[model samples]
Target: MSSHVKLRKERGTIAECETQVKEIRSQMAEQLKSLDLHVEMRVQLLQDLSEFFRRKAEIETEYSRGLEKLAERFSSRIRNSKEPQHSRKEQDLLSSVSCWHLILNHTRQESREHAVLSDTYSNSMVVRLCHITEDTGRLSKKSKDIGLQMQEQLLKVTSELQTAMKTYNQYHTDSMNAEGKLKEVEKLEERHMGKSADPGLGQSGVDAKQQRSSTLKKMERLKEKRQAKFLENKLKCTKARNDYLLNLAAANAAMNKYYLQDVCSLIECCDLGFHLSLGVTLRLYLSAQSRVQQSQQEAVGVLEGAVQGLDPPGDQKKILEMNHTAFCLPFRFEYQPHEGDQVCVVSAEAQVRNELVTRFQQLQSRLSSVSLETEEVNKTMKATLKALLDSFSFEDFSSSDSLQTSQSAESVKSSGSDPPGNKPNIAKRRANQQETESFYFTKVKEYLSGCSLISKLQAKHDLLKEAIEKAEGIDSDPSRLQCSNRSLRVRKQRPCSQYNHKLFTGDLQQFVESSGQLIPLVVESCIRFINLHGLHHEGIFRVPGSQSEVNEIRNAFERGEDPLTDLTDHNIDSVAGVLKLYFRGLEKPLFPQEKFQELVECVQIENKLERACHIKKVVGCFPQAVLIIMRFLFAFLNHLSQYSDENMMDSHNLAVCFGPTLVAVPLDQDAVSVQPRVNEVVKTIIMFHEKIFPGARELEGPLYEKCMTEEEEYW
Candidate 1:
């Protein structure tokens, strides 16, 4: 009975729900049709505005031409009239008519151009707004569809529940009916037993009672099974409903998050576009300023020339006043078309230039205001983004945040009242943030399309480009030739060698700062210099700078001039070259290039004892002075590394750049024959460089292997 009642209730609810669904579908369809109509209206509005501007321009042109024709007819009538007294007055009236006509034409042209520009800007703004509205409309439609889907899911679950309840009822009724018949039969058996006391009849009655009890037990088992099945179906329906709800909530949240993220991204794009526009505007402003300044200079020059042409005996103050008048008076027009026309054009140009300067100043002020507004908008956007990030624990918006981290119904139920996936506070905060974000993006779009900020910026850029071309043309003019003047007086100059005298003074700090990694080239040059000069055994070397200049520099230093500050690039190179030669004069050559391979091979031995013995033997072959100098060089490099990472002179990398220079081939052999030797010496230098440098640690195993592999290929 309960099952039948549930079935009836479900049947009634389904029809009602279907009617609601139909109503909702109709409402959504109407909304979509309305949105389409709105879009079409916006497009049509733009078209109408465009047509209005076209008609306005045509009217202005026609009006200007009509005025010109009227002025001509008036002038002709005045010229043809025979009245002498009226002739002069008519001539004046005709001149006024011509002037008025010109003014009307100029004003009309300016107004028409301004109107067209304004219409274009307005049209662009409308289009941008339409795009925003369309996006919102789509979002609304998607939300409606999700609602419809949820309704459908609820109805399906209701139908399944009705069927399960009906099955449960049928099983239960059958079980109860069996028990009722068994009770009736037992009462009948007691009445019959009192009339017939036969043993066979009594046994038959006992058998009948036993059979009924068995039937009752079977019915109870069958009912229990049906009840278990019904319970399972109920749990399934409940789970399905919960899942549907969770999915709907997740979808809603996801859409909101997506919209907010897109808005943030759009805001960022706008910020970038604004900055780029500002940069372009700034360039144009600078170019315009330059051109204006140049024009002003030319105008001032013309005025100065006019001043110079004035009577020489005139009073100085009067002459100055006359010059000012000459500058200001030329913009006036003469009806006679006299020689003053050229001066008038020039003066008019000067006035135009002045106006341009004022306008440029205004442009700069507007740009600054725009920049400040853009910055404020960006800050607001970032703050909203930060709030969103804080409220929702999303690692990144680059992927689908909802799809990847959506919580199932089971997880939500397990987590109890406060599910980890969705927080009420967070959802509320996100909604607020989303609203603010939409408003900000709307503002950003308004600013972008406002008075055509981007278009104005582009115009400025084009103007700047044109100005640059003009400037370039002027620069290329043949009239402005570079003078080939030269000074005849002699001055004391430093020799290259004198600058290098300090290299052997043992100033490691100066060496690192000046030469950096160029130390290798300097060293190579120095070594070749020593070899060429046969200075290997010399205890002293001549300084390279001019003697007089060197003495002067020394005196200045003695007078407390700082050496490092005084050092120049040439001086640094010369010092490095000199230092290289100092190595040749060592008690033993640093690498002992003659035995480079033997030394490296000794260090490469597998047996520690054998390797140590061979290294000792190789060291003993060189003079003790060479070992001392090698240690000093490595320590200096380590110190230099601390100061600058460039010269670095680290064990592995320094060897690569300077390796070949360190490898000295025999006089009778070419470099190719000594390639193996160079490799060995590079290895030897790196090995000892690590061991001798105080702070050096053994190379990491992988890095050491990579270095060795590179070295083999390099050699």
Candidate 2:
């Protein structure tokens, strides 16, 4: 049942009504107190929420500021950079520049969005919540005030009722006391009359009668006073009772109104006002957050679309097209005669012969000096090795005179004759000898490296001499000289060929003879190109070139055109591929087919010195042209391999790439079966080119001895 119905059924007497009123008032007061506390708690919650949003706004503002600064910093750097934006060094990054710029733009946009979000949280959400808190708090305070006023009015009525009840009880008690006194006096008078009726003791009776008469008079007066007091007390008590009844009724009515209407209205107002304002404020918060989220979502979608639309190749092509002038082919150099010698026709053949003779003479002098140094170094190394060996044993000193001339030999003989306790000295001497041996080996490597240098110089020397001889031979023949002069004139006038002339698929010897070069022109050109441009290129020989570019370069070379002279349009790999293609298409492999097995067997020898010697012997059987080309090519390869850290093509990798191209196999033999041996032979030749080729006689003692030890370990 409802509280109102229950209160109505429980209301019986004034006391019961008052008791019920007290309980209802107590309950309502507690509820009001609870409502006040709840209001305060809600207000505090709203304050805390506002503080949270305020802090969030601060954090977002800071984050947005940081993002803006970051984007601005990078964009400024990109703008202020001094280097070309699309140079070759930056080509790889050029395609992504637009994407990076897009990211920066979107990041700035996101910063703006966050700034707006911060404003929303600080101005919109927080403001609305504060308003709601204020409204709820004001409503709660007003409701509490109204409830307190009603409660105070009920207390006033209850206090009046208590005072009236006290007055009525006091009056009734005074009236009852008076009535008892009057009744007691009447009983005494009746007892005195009975005594006067008796005959005995006349005088005492007369005295008693007199006393009784006086007492009667006194009793009559007292009765009259008592009767007056009783009537007045009765009237006063009736008035007091009437006032008590009126106050009780008034108190009951006041309490009933308070519990039934006032308290209920106050509680409902507080609850409804607080909840309504809270609901509105929360809805505002949600709406603001949703709007911010929707904005951010749209921004993110746009950013995603931009990110997804990035096209690297298209960007690269566009950049290339825009910078076309930067990539134009450089002009060729033209001959310019001296200012005053325009008509002075110089004999080209005589000029060429003089240049050749000068180079040959220079190389010849260098060879003589280098040969003398090699002999000196060889002598020193042999002496060091012999001293090291002789220090260990005295028996090798065949004569006592030799032992007497050597300190180490004398020490060995003395130690051999000494007691067993002197073996430590002998051991110490042997350790010193071993140390000397190590030093000897170090010098031997130096000597061998010198020999290798001499070999290279010797090769250049021989090439220059041949050119000079060829020039001299042409000069010696009058008929050949006239033909050469006429042909040279026609060649200078001839235009470059446009069609392929089948230069690659020819015999190596034939190409060398036709070009009057120790090595083919194609080989020389490719080697020069790689040396100039691709020595430090990673995976120089292993990485495949673009097939179309390789074919284009190959056709140009086959037409006797110098495609490699201007290499801006070609990559290093393409030129390397052309070189490999020329060798692959050769009519006869550089190493003759019949010699393939012998070379393979020599490479497989167990002793490194013997293996190198045998391989050198077999390589010696090749023609002079072949030897010259091998020296040229392997010399270039050895130099190139020194840059293995950058190019990643060491001797092993080069051998693997060129083994099949340079070495020939018999038809009866499976190329796959002997493939490992072929690569081994080529690797050995490249590594031991200084040893295998006859350049310096210094390879006999210490050089070959060190080779036997160190190269054995290397193999």
Count of clashes, each model: 6, 0
Q: How close is candidate 1 to the true structure, as a TM-score?
A: 0.26
Q: Write the per-residue lDDT of candidate 1 for residues 1-715, one digit (tens) a residue.
A: 9647645654554445445435534543443344344335535654564455456445644553554465457656656777796666665568786686566544444333333223222332233233333433443343334333433433343344334333433343344445455555555555554434543348888887666666666656655666655555544433333222322233333223222232233223322222222222223222322332455776556654553453322332342353332211111111111111121111112323444344434654565566567666565455444433332232111111111211332222232222232343334434654554464445544443332342343333333333333534544322122456653322222112223224333333333344332232233333322222322221112223345543443444333232222223223323333454444333334567567667656645666455545665665565433444344454333333332232223444334334454445556654433444354444454455544322313211111111121012100
Residue 605, candidate 2: alpha-carbon lDDT: 85
lDDT of each: 0.38, 0.60
Q: Clashing residue pairs in candidate 2, if any?
A: none
Cα deviation at 13, candidate 1, in Å, is 1.1
Candidate 1 backbone overlaps, count? 6
Where is model 2 more than 4 Å wrong at Cα?
A: 1-36, 63-112, 132-148, 192-221, 268-272, 294-715
